[model samples]
Target chain A: MLNRPASDTQITHARRLWLYAVAVLVMAFLILPTFVVIPMSFSDSRFLRFPPQGFSLRWYESYLTSPEWMQATWVSLKVAVLTTLLATPLGIAASYGLHVSRVPFSRVLTIALISPLIIPIIILGVGIFYLYVRLGVVNTIPGLVMAHTILAIPFVVVTVSSGLQQYDSNQELAARNLGASRWTAFRTITLPQIRGSIVAGGLFAFITSFDEVVIALFISGGQNTTLTRRMFTGLRDEIDPTIAAISSLLIVLSVIMLLILVLSNRQK
Target chain B: MSKLSVRSQPIAIRDVTKTYGSFNALENVTLDIAAGEFLTLLGPSGSGKTTLLMVLAGFTRATSGHVLVGSQDMTRVPPHKRDFGMVFQNYALFPHMNVFGNVAYPLRLRRVSRSEIDTRVARALDLVQLSHLAERPIDALSGGQRQRIALARAIVFEPRVLLMDEPLSALDKNLREQMQIEIRNLHENLGITTVYVTHDQREALTMSDQVVVIDAGRISQKGAPREIYERPANAFVADFIGESTLLPVQAGADGFAFGGRALRATVAPPGGLFLVARPEKMELHRTDMDPAYNLFEGTLHQLVYQGETVLAQVALPEGQTISMRLTSRREVMAALPEPGKPITLALHPEDTVIVPERGQ
Candidate 1:
């Protein structure tokens, strides 16, 4: 009974019938088109259409077998995973330090760390492209990973910072009081409690890097090109049916990440 | 569980002061806690009691002071090295850990053998009478159960010093009272030197071998519960520890006089400005009362019939009202005079207490 949400029970379902209608309409308006690609990707038609000519595995087979598409997928995965690894720890450290820091301007430092999310991505893309050129790292794996990490960090920092906020830091103090060192207290007490937030933050970083196109367009090219960049180039050059299959796959990946985030939170 | 034992050590806090800019959270406070003694720092909120506890726990650094545990000066020691066990106000049990895990945390930190950890953890859980719930999640327990679990965890490591900051405040009144006796008993068995902090005077009285009453940033008074209650050092302690009326008195060549009437007491004046009268000690005077009892004439103002006791409020000639407490027995209620009637109240010399106007 306590876990039940305190919803507007005063308004009966019949009385608020229009609200459900409007909610369905709003969700359908925003989400309905993204789902259309699923069925179209299965179509054996020459052109992408809502009503497919007939269902077949040709486009999916094309995506799975094509070496370029497979390479782009591999690149996206590598970059996303690497970005998750690099950004999670840095973001968690910044947030933890900021949480316990009595030093001045920690708030300003947090804002600076999370500024990438607030800054216009196109502008950041141009700026990174210029910096990468000067550093002689454009079109390289390191350049792609570095750029993607920069874009992914803000999401990690924001999520993990929020996680740190909800956690009661006194547990760490209690651990210290019970003979655990400061670092041990954090690892044994503080870390396990906020594991959900850290995982969620990592997921956010992974998704941000995986779907990022603006920065990849500017600095990523050749062998290091991300799947998003490849998809963009393919769409620009003649819309391939394989793009539909890949879009369906991207949508599934995003859904899986969202599910993971929701499931982790539920465990907490 | 019965075999669980704790080592005891005396704590000496000398001239400890904690200052944040111009505000003094603790002001030159010094206290010595005897080995295995249950001492309570009792005060109102923001009275620096918890701050003093923190200083002892090494969580808060004193601006200048020395904390000697046994003979070692541990003033510069960090909390982790201090080896003190503390139960936080909210218990601070790891949400990710089960009951056994929560209680086993401190032992695990010391890298106790896995088999020994299981035995000791189970014993601690048995001590708290929650061994059956060893695998239960923290949030699954009730408030009172969590309080017991917190106690079990704090004492499981057998630290020489155990600090508790309002651990029972979250429990309901009945549970709080039950836990108070339970903790006092546990302290007797374990013999760990304990320092507890609470704003509740009754809890302090029921649990502590010594009580330090803090107000503002200083110790107002420290004594045994009966001594503090029976002979409060000043008006503050007199009023804070129990129900009392502080009737302003001026010191004269003879003795302290309350509004030109001499107040007689078996206990001498504490060299203060108020004659503290406890309502429960004052009775409705009968014609055959002791001749040496102090007498006051007043008009009955109101009679409050509480479930357990009856309070008869009286308005003195000078307009200072003092209540007289009476048991709510059938005969006692029948013998009471109605409001607006004149009455005489008596106080035995031993029941009278005089204190200074301010705690100073």
Candidate 2:
């Protein structure tokens, strides 16, 4: 006969096994969709039907050769680059001012500065649509770029602020004590410490603006359509297998960018 | 300015007061530091030691005071304009820069020639004995090594004065003691008037030419180390500066008395008093036979062997206990007193400092 306590231990072990099974199931739940899209992108078919009869790189080739897709891709790259350039320095300056200000309502000021992040993107899209229209920026590349930068600035602020938190304020003072001007202290001592955060923030802003579709939909139309907008249009007009191909390529690009970020940070 | 015996010395702060809202961080403080004096602002936490240092360094502004270096008023000067060197509590070495670059930074900002900057950086590194590791990244250095690097960087510019805020407080006991002597030696060699801040009384006493004791944002006492330790102005200074076993005593026209035993005192009675005694000053005997002045009959309550010294807790008949430190090895070698053994302890009247029992 099995000992009574031994049986109880077996039951407890079985319950733990069940719990582990559930946890693994939940983990799979989150990762399933991302993996599923990869194989579906390789399908040699007219539609995005999974478990394809064969696999081919025909759709990838199709995207590569298409002038419209190429143009949209270039536009997205240009916008992401412009947004990063415009957002990073502005965000850093704004954060520096907010950090150093001896104002009574500093907390209120920070909240107000970062309110763009809290407001719904849909509302931002609507507001930008009307404003851009009034400013005669509709369907213009510069207008779309400016709109994307506004969306990206908050991420830059938050990330750069985190970097500034680890910085030694006294180090700047030490610089000043050595006969450097205030600006010189800031440039020599203050800037180098938080450069990582600033770069990281720039990368984030780039990606946000690049992959953005909502504001692009509102402000950009016709010839100025972004790659994301093009992809959305492609999906709506037809169940294009090219969407899967384009998405797969975008995912690879994102992974590569993420690797660069991780590698640079690690090297630091 | 002359290299030695300049017309004006290092620094002078006159009636400096710093306030945060209604709380005074430092109040009406004045001090003059000689060109080569190694002065320490020593106090416990919240004692405005750091505040005063910051004010002098130009990182902090005083609400109502004037700070002068040489003949120039520096009260309105910003830190960078004042041209002082400083070491922070956490070392604060630039993590991104290698050791050589960190030491060379201030020189670069001053627009020194590149070759001179390199020469000075190497010399600074040599001064800290870190020349071999000049190219190593800051994160590669150990805590003690990083601390030395910070010191090297601060001095690379050859500032007229150096300020340090608890630079060794983060180090372990052994490293802190070692760095203390190293820093003291550095100060003597360079003859750069330095202001050091710390709360460790032992560090202050060991390292400084003069020690200023602060409490609650005010200077409670300031003197040479021996003077501050031996003649603290009030009960706070006396108790805070060193370990003291204070006993409740009555000082009347006759003499001082505690626990029904009359004791000798140096000064005539001003009022009721609390006598402060250093444990090391009290002598102990095994048997209760003492005709010496300021002697009391007691029982041995506890014995603690503390490496270099043995601590004895003696109990009077009234159940009051006082600790006595005995440094004699022969005393411990003999039969140690068991708990409750009758004993006698003697204290010199001169060593018994009488303080008023106000705010006890």
Candidate 3:
């Protein structure tokens, strides 16, 4: 008991000090640009600057008071929430049905459900634009939500499928043998065990819809323009500090989502 | 207690056969269990013992057959509708629930009163002698304790038929033996018509009133523990149920002959092509070979001493070898001849078993 065997796992805390240095470099390379935008949002100059000439909240005031910017932010918020509500249940049902069903081509059905994730965003945007024109829903909030839901569903399906695969289905059968009906067994025994993964998937769906730009550019315009699409247009016309302020806020939202995901994984 | 109101039921499986593609998992299997009888379907893995138990529990539908529960046809009944209690091999206790919640799950589904659910859960936990740990999380329990909680959860509703699928296979030897006696005692108190599935011959012998040996998708032998161990119907059952070297024999209308001599066994359903010589049932004959006993001429090959007994391996004339066990309690252990010396081994007439030889 006194001598612990040396295992294959890398005990990086005591050994391999260089690994931590490399990890810090990689994190800075990936994330340092996002933090660079935070100080630029407070610049008093007319244009965005990484090292601000003077510190002020004029850009934040412009984003909050302008009618066009406020309307775009509200549209983005409504579409993201609606997309999350619609996509999560559909993705869960698809994943669970594929797991339990003995029907032929279930593998093919799974591939079809996740096909939106692999397709090029430009091509998918063009396809959705054509479909929305025929359906007469272009430039509307409902059209934006429907387009974003399609993009968000793959995240939910991938997360929930991993959770289901880790679960032992015999627990459901045990519940059924103990006198619970099939639906009752799933509700009481199966769902509660996989709750952490379900919440994670819902968070992923929310972030996916909130950050979408290509599909919104194709389908949304005028009063239904989303925040991301409005920011894209603002950058195209001129370099504005208002877009930097909005990007800093989006970065904070993403950080909160990552924190929630980490906490959910700890529960599992 | 109020838990004594369980109505035990008999089960009947008539001509059940289950096949996957071209392979038969169970073929023409028919068994009838009496009320409150503990029957074990014993076989090696993939030998259809588990499939038969699943059919009885309504989890696997038979290809063509009828299953009757207390004179009611339940061949098409779903598992949820059957009301048969089952304990899985992994002890599938709900991880999110505490011990009390796991035990009270069935009662909650049945719409039992909340107060009654609490009392019944307490009683079930008491049955397993784990009443003090009712609020403990399931992940905190050890393997043996988890097994007991699974048992408590399965029987809390007092379903008429209780089925267990090798629930003790995960346990160590000492704990397994302890749970065996505990389960048998629980069966005696509940008096439920039980069907247990286990590949362990000793476990089946220790726990059940009826032992059914299945081989390659068919019933090979069915009898009491002593009956199957002493007089296996075929070479497969004989070799599977105990430690034995089955010597080929000649059986005819005249009688059974082994090694150029006749064999008369006074055990169950006799007459086959293989003579079963159990090592423990054989004796190291030191004096002149008696004609009344079935005798063999061989040289002492070796001796194996293991704690309480020493095994003597003797090589016969035709390159065949046989073994006999001498207990440490006997003085004959000191009298066993050295290796390569001419020795004689003997078997009483009642101790010899002859069984038909079947293909693997």
Candidate 2 residue-wise lDDT at B177: 97
Q: Per-residue lDDT of B1-360 in model 1, one digit per residue for the tens?
A: 256877799999999999999999999898999999999999999989999999999989999989999999989999988888888999988888999989998998888999999999989888888999999999899998888898889988888898999999888889999999999988998888999999999999999999999988898888999988998988889888889988877788877777677878766555768778899999888899888788889999999989899999999997799999999999888877889999889998888777876565
Supply the global lDDT for candidate 1.
0.89
Q: Which candidate comes out best when scored by TM-score?
A: 3
TM-score rank order: 3, 1, 2
Candidate 2 lDDT over B173-210, as tens digits, reads: 99999999999988877888889999999999999999
What Cα-based lDDT does every candidate model obtain?
0.89, 0.82, 0.89
Query: DockQ scores for all the models shown?
Result: 0.75, 0.54, 0.79
Residue B248: error of model 3 in Å? 1.0
What are the per-residue Cα lDDT tens digits for candidate 3 across A18-70?
A: 78889999999998888889999999999977688898899999999999999
lDDT of 1 by residue, A165-221 (tens): 999998998889988889999998888878898999999999999999999999888
List the candidate numbers ranked by DockQ, top first.
3, 1, 2
For model 1, the superposed segments whose C-alpha errors exceed 4 Å read A1-22, A39-67, A101-110, B266-271, B286-290, B329-338
Colliding residue pairs in candidate 3: none
Model 3 stretches with alpha carbons more than 4 Å out: A1-21, A101-109, B1-3, B267-271, B286-291, B358-360
| Cα error of candidate 3 at position B138, Å | 0.6
lDDT of 1 at B299: 94
